[model samples]
Target: MTRLDAYLNRIGIARPSELDAAGLLAVQAAHRQAIPFENIDVRLRQAIPTESQAVFDKLVTQRRGGFCFEHNRLLSDMLAAMGMANRVLLARVTFGDPPALPPLTHCLLLVTLPDGQRMIADGGFGGTYCPPLPLADGAEATSGDGARHRLTQIGAPGTLPGEWLLERMGPPETSDGRGRDHAAWEQQYAFELADTAPADLVMGSHFASTHPSARHVNCHVASRVLPDGFVSLLERQFSRYRAGHPVERREVADVAEYRDLLAREIGVDLPVETLDRLPLWAGAD
Candidate 1:
């Protein structure tokens, strides 16, 4: 079978007849739900090549997951193969405590649908929108799985002209009485619609996958979007979430159990030898 066919099978979706917004949403949701966001290769001491074919091989053929660059690059290539127009974009991650500034390290897509409407299609971010978010600033978009997100232009003092911020909107209970609740909506990342070349992503992926200070290099991070909520594995801690329900978390116990959880829960299959080599909390305390 062709790589496209393999990818479609991996995501458990058949090719759609038309590449419209609905079709785009279906594909994006499938990709997010099927291929998890992970950094197992980094922990295994394997080099992650930023090329499209390498990414496809690992994600589709080997049944492995990857970080932003790998996941989004593969999705972008697939969209291109299906005759859709998409531009790769980079963003600086700011979701962490104290926030990461500068050196745009996250990769995503700006796709023009069949009807000429532009949207942001991202399969990499764990807790963001599933269906593509409309590119219009201040316009809200809801994912198929019920997550709400929006985009807004950031102004002044370190923000560039046209720099857009993608924020995740909290549910009603999390909102304060005032309309302007900083705690109500959280900023996922800051990015501009400026063109991002392949080389830019290669450099960004290099730092994200290998740098000692990079967060991915330190922990066993993996996440998958579920029908109701989400499943995530951080270091040895595994957590499951459902909308309107509390987060359920547990310790992974040992390497064998960790490997089993990856294969069974997250849908990633890694060799036993490789799993044995991975350091527990490689860069974390």
Candidate 2:
């Protein structure tokens, strides 16, 4: 029998016996607090895992962060062991410049609770909420991270319809002695309720992590949400973004600081051999 207690303990899911909305929130909190969304394996030339056990061994045992494949796959397994029914949904993410990427590059999960209600459970997207969102159109999901996010329906249900967009209103940037106030709502990703296997995700994720043109392979930036601000490590500089304001950045002089930040904030550790190559991912040194 799959042990729910052990898995919950590993992920810090506290209140499994409660099995109510509160319990769901607890599970989501545990996941966000314990697991980190990261792409360190790409620098190490490690093979992205394809099984739930492999993900558990890499994350729980080895203490590492992973891309969507490993992160959500293990999370889904944990949820299933906890007696929750969930569906794996595929999404394409657009982050940096263009805004949204094409479909099939991201993965999310839809969870069905005992009350026959559906929620969005995601642990792989860095800096996202720990709890699932009510799978209802026009419902807003506010996270502990201070981001006001809502899901809007694009098309009719069962038509393989619209996107679940995550949006935020932030202060505008002031440059060259000019001040501007504006609102920005970008689509993180969109997906339908479809089941995706771990093995399948691994194959596609491998290409994205290794492809020379992919944004992830080209940038060494990693971020995690904090109560007061967000910590982002880009190359040697550590930046802090707070409540939609100018970022505070500092250059890291010692390499140990980089490793320590990964361990402390992002919940990851770099292998000894990969330490020298870390700068390669950061496009530094």
Candidate 3:
């Protein structure tokens, strides 16, 4: 088993164990606070590894945040080290301005406790960690913050019995047919228990990073959740979403300052070669 103290300390998870709801919340909070949700490595020529040691080296040893595969894989390993039984699953992410590429897939973790209880633990999701949703559908789960999120079964068996959906109830906002208002929330990601192997994500990750059509190739976006709301860093703007409030967007002027924030605030510092790619977005100004 991996050392729990080292793993928790690496991610700033101060809690003793993430076995219950409170502990789970602490783990999520620490994950968002410590590790960044970034695609910079993909932008760089750095190849994210699929093996456990390589993942640990890249994420824990190197102190970097990765996409779904890197984050969930490491998290799963950490849980295992903590003597927790867990499984890995894959999901096709449909985010804001969804990726146009074919294998724009995602990875998440499913953990089962000794009591036959199952919960979803995902520190990989950029800005949403409402709570640990039960593996069973039609189950309503609420985070410690009082945000109500639920999982509902989506597809039928003999096809994808593990298929499920998620939704959260938030504040109201002006609608634009993007599903509904801010209060209505939206479909986060659709996932199932199809038993996706780590090898599958490796191939997908390679394609995503190398393909010119991938979203990571076009722009830069880094997001991490906070106790209240969240903070996101886009091309030249930093947006903060506070609890019970709309998102606050700020334009960053200094090119040097933007790079500094990417390193300091985002926690995933890019190398010199990767830093040179910023000019591609100069026309946006």
Candidate 4:
């Protein structure tokens, strides 16, 4: 089957009848729902290959989910196959709220609509902002999952020129219950408008997958955006959020439950035995 056909079928969405905002939203949302944002292979200490054929084989033919590099690269290719104009841009992730800037390790797809509007698909951030938001300065959008996000152009981080900052509305206060007014808009990432070079993506993907301190190497993480909320697994903790509110949080009992939870809530299936490679599971009770 053609690449476009296979992609649409994998995501369980028919070809778009038109090339518009709604169409872009549907395509992106469906992709997020079907293909989870995950770091399973990294956790398993496997090599990460960003090449087209390798990514297509692992994420598509093998029916597995991957992180930003793999996810966005495949999405970019799929969009191109569907006659959509798009480019990949690397970004510095800010999910941890670090004191200083992080490396440019995330991949985001920027697409030009028929009307000249540029919509950005979140590199591999599932369960958070799934819809494509306009790349324009001060562009604010609420995703289908009801998560609020705003993108604004600003001076690039750490002595660079200009770049855009994407922020998501996070919880109201700090985890310690320190009083903070409204649920603040947390910085998600920052990226320049320029198209990322192929070599840069290769290096970035390597850093994210093989770096000793990278989150993927240290712990397990997977997320899937739901129709009305989000479901995610971080290390051993499993969480479900609804309408921006935390509804459930608990530790996964063991590897068996982890595998079942991924299939039950996220719609992504994997070999149960391979999951034992994770550090948490590698050790005996």
Candidate number with greatest TM-score: 4
| Candidate 3, residue 277: lDDT | 61
Q: Write the per-residue lDDT of candidate 3 for residues 1-285, one digit (tens) a residue.
A: 345666777877564444664565567668766887777766655676777788777778788777767778888887776656888877655534354423436677788876668888787765355467678867776543335677888886424323676666553111011224445546666677767665788876776566787666656667666566556676677766566667666787665667777787667676645566664345644
Looking at model 1, report the run of 10 residues with the lowest lDDT sum: 172-181
Candidate 4's residue-wise lDDT over 115-202, tens digit each? 8888888637642554688878888877654557788888754444238888777442211111132367776778887757789999
The lDDT of each candidate is 0.76, 0.63, 0.65, 0.75
Query: Candidate 1 lDDT, tens digit per residue, 221-277?
Result: 777877666777777878776676875778987778888988888888777677877
Native RMSD of candidate 4 (Å): 3.3
Flag the better candidate by TM-score, 1 or 2.
1
In model 3, the runs with Cα more than 4 Å from the true position are 1-3, 15-18, 97-104, 142-147, 158-162, 171-180, 244-247, 270-274, 279-285
Of the two candidates 3 and 4, the one with more favorable lDDT, higher being better, is 4
- Give the CA lDDT, 0 to 100, for residue 248 in model 2: 69
**Per-residue accuracy of model 2 over 73-191 as CA lDDT, tens digit each:** 88788777777888788765543335344546677788888888888878777534334678887667555545556666665534432355544433221110011323565455566
Worst 10 residues of 4 by lDDT: 172-181
Clashing pairs in 1: none
TM-score, structure 2 vs. true: 0.81
